[model samples]
Target: MSRTLSVLFILVCYVIQGQSQQVDQDSIKNLRLNILPVVFYTPETGLGYGALGLSTFRLKGEELSTRPSSVQLGITFTSKKQFLMFMPYEFYLDEEKWRFKGELGYYKYFYNFYGVGMDSREEDKELYTADFPRFRLAAYREIFQDFSIGLGYEFDGYHVLEPEPDGLLDTSLDIIGKEGGTISNIGFLALYDTRDNIFHPTKGWYVEGAFYHSARWLGSNYSYQKIELDTRYYQQIKGNVILATNLFLGTRSNGTPFQDLNYLGTKRTRGFDNRRYLDKNEVSLATELRFPLYKRLKGAVFGATGTVIPSLDQTFKASYKGAVGGGLRYIVNKKEGTRLRVDYGISGDGGQFYFTINEAF
Candidate 1:
């Protein structure tokens, strides 16, 4: 019952200004700005309208071979009276030896939650409204070719604005985070990336592992730990044809909050409701076949399977979910390989459409 259609009107403007004469002349020091007005529809949000802006630029002495850094901002409001504002950015500094990325966002939104675990029934769905502010920051220094290690901080202040009367969230004593609270965590990150291009990689591998711990001493209401591993591979098959695949594994300690539990049906799974299943552990694998269609336009077909388990011992006995989808991509920034993506996915429950800025992985 989830769907989105984003009509994008793009405006691109380039600004060229000289900094100090001391700046390196070999650097490409121009800024490119793209603005798009977006309109979309979803059963949960009704009709939504928004504006998305992206600014891409290179630092003073950075070479063209280095990936360009980008800052993206978005604001949206729905007819249902929900709204969201977010800013996400990525920077490649010091000749691409240092990488910094994160997101800062505030959401006044509604989410559907079923009772936790794979056994949760579809009929048990409940809608809840919440407002929250989120901040995440990570910095990594390349230790070797295509390898880096880093540290990150994450924080979220979540408050429930509305909960269904007599619903599971209101009555269930087993549910943690039913009455939202602060979530503060510190984490370690390791990444090994060899992609030819940041936006659209035709060949390479990207592997990342992260571990995070949240404790009362860290200003968290609950104490828990989380571990996640995401691995991706991309390869060119033939002329203008590419194959991309991803596998993600995640697990959390027993004390993890319900909101922090592993779930399918996000950008990761795409076809089910958001947080369709929740549990302490999860495994998902997806693959896509990408090929050129026309000038500035590309096409892709993707399939994914995933499952969530309440405990590690139950992993082998878990019920799995599957999704299949196809989408179109329009190259928004040809030089940087940035694209506008629109995808429609189908699952056992139903189908959903997604509109976004980049690849799901």
Candidate 2:
């Protein structure tokens, strides 16, 4: 079976098993825990198996109105010798006045590289393997209603195990991070959010801006600065129907690694291969229409357009890429409004599928 399909089947099994499992609840601690097994198949990975544990809780003295915090831990290994271990957590403290979120993980994985610009051709695609340990942490405190200022630190120790001989990485002396290296950065962010719901917003605005710098003094192999801005708006069109729009902007300094450059594809731009187009600057815009399909089920149609360029001045002149797609959502946690999302996107090259546990943005 195809990798995506096999994963979907496993997720379906998980849903069935999840419904029958008894959640461990501690009333005194206001915590609930669920543990499950993961299994899937794919041509590249052969058989993959893992375990996942998730815990949701409210801090002591925190009112029920405060958002519930969650921590997820997972470990997986595949027959082809790939493996991953990770912990991701999000917490709301002080009655929503403070928020903290981050992830720590290590993984051995493969990625497709197709040169590093909008003009890159599909024929240049090459697969490479790498292993990396990553750490990311962010803390935010609301200064006033719905406005927050934050600080964050991130680290990634990347080691390329295999690079295609005679390929771009091997042939190009200009490519930074060709051998993989450490990326450490500290950043500051400002956010303004008014969305009524974090999982599925019906109406409101979310705007965020951040700046980070990685330098030799900070244990980074390369020195560079990056700036990013993301803005989103949601509006209720009618009963149970909503329209959402997003715009993203990013730029990095000269010494930035190719892997760290802004890209045209990610969760932000569906339908295209991940990091299909990479450069020093990028601008993207997307919109989605969401509506209820049935009880606890939702549907969405989205479109996006973006471009990557070496500099901001060339943004308008750069070749643009676009995509259109649709997706389904099944609510998994009613209280938290979390949903299992499945989307299929189409672009000039072909179709791409995505499956996950939350909205793209």
Candidate 3:
């Protein structure tokens, strides 16, 4: 537990983005601008982080479905860590409101550490730098009442980081040979989400399924030939309460491809280091419970478990391992439709506590 605390991470408050045009009757459409600012702390890294994000929407008169499209831009910075992100995305809604077409225009992520390799002997220590440009184009269709199915092609990857000097541990990663590679998966997907609405804080169930082929590219896990299945569920207990869950099952002919692209920090599991469980085959599960404490303020509790096996050839079962904890979520702005979520949870293995955004799914 001391080691976890020693990492010096700060609690992070997640703020969602942007708005719709609320204007008088206009020409073909109305344009609106939406922006969001976020601040967070990492108790493990003793780091402070901030983000500014914006979105532009085109509305067709008062039809709501007349002009269905939006563009987004965002940037992130940190005080303790040097990592940053610049993202731009575009989305489109069909005239019938039955489908959503979208694409992430650009995604640029830069990762940096304060004291990585000071070893004078290792020349590669200086080469420690990672960044990537990624994008995805997806379309969602209303399969049932509020349920939906989605399909798309995605390309995400890591900018190459240089090898560490011999005998020196690269703070950038675990395996010494990892150079941070690019991964692209062209596939199909299906999803179902019913959360009252996409803009405000209402809860329901959300499930997703995706399949892709790496075609021997950076996206290929061990050596291409990969498939992944992901599912999620969110429920509102009475009215002000919520419960969330996540499940993932994936494998590649050689292994899985998307696991290695995690270049930033621990996103899901608290007890284990980020990307610690990447293997030929992987399975993971997580859950969370939340309730509203007061106007603009909410609290939550969560837990998680996951593991990786060497191959699909061998049948491996999950041991249901993870963490548990709780935190507060403040509805920072009603007009902005933004919420600042700060959650803390501990892992089952060592009961390590962690705090972060959303529901950890």
Which residue pairs in candidate 1 have backbone atoms (N, alpha carbon, C) closer than 3 angstroms, thus clashing?
none
What overall lDDT, based on C-alpha atoms, would model 3 receive against the true structure? 0.50
In order, what lDDT does every prediction score? 0.83, 0.81, 0.50
Q: Among these predicted structures, which one has the highest lDDT?
A: 1
Residue-level lDDT of model 3, residues 19-84, one tens digit each, is 445554453344555445555444423454555454444444335533335454555555645455
Q: Which residue runs of candidate 1 sit more than 4 Å off their true CA positions?
A: 1-28
For candidate 2, report its TM-score: 0.90
Write out the backbone clash pairs for model 2.
none
Better of 1 and 3 by TM-score: 1
Candidate 2 segments exceeding 4 Å error: 1-12, 16-29, 32-42, 51-54
**Candidate 2 residue lDDT tens string, 1-361:** 2223434434432542233222333332456555656776655566788876666677665676777788878788988899888998888888889989899999897677888888899888787787999898989999999999999888888765578999987788988888889999999989898998876888999999999989577799989999999999999999989999999999998988876889876877898877788999999999999999999999999999999988999978889989999999887667667676788887786667776666888
Candidate order by TM-score, decreasing, is 1, 2, 3
Model 3 TM: 0.68
lDDT of 2: 0.81
Best by TM-score: 1
Error of 2 at 361 (Å): 1.0
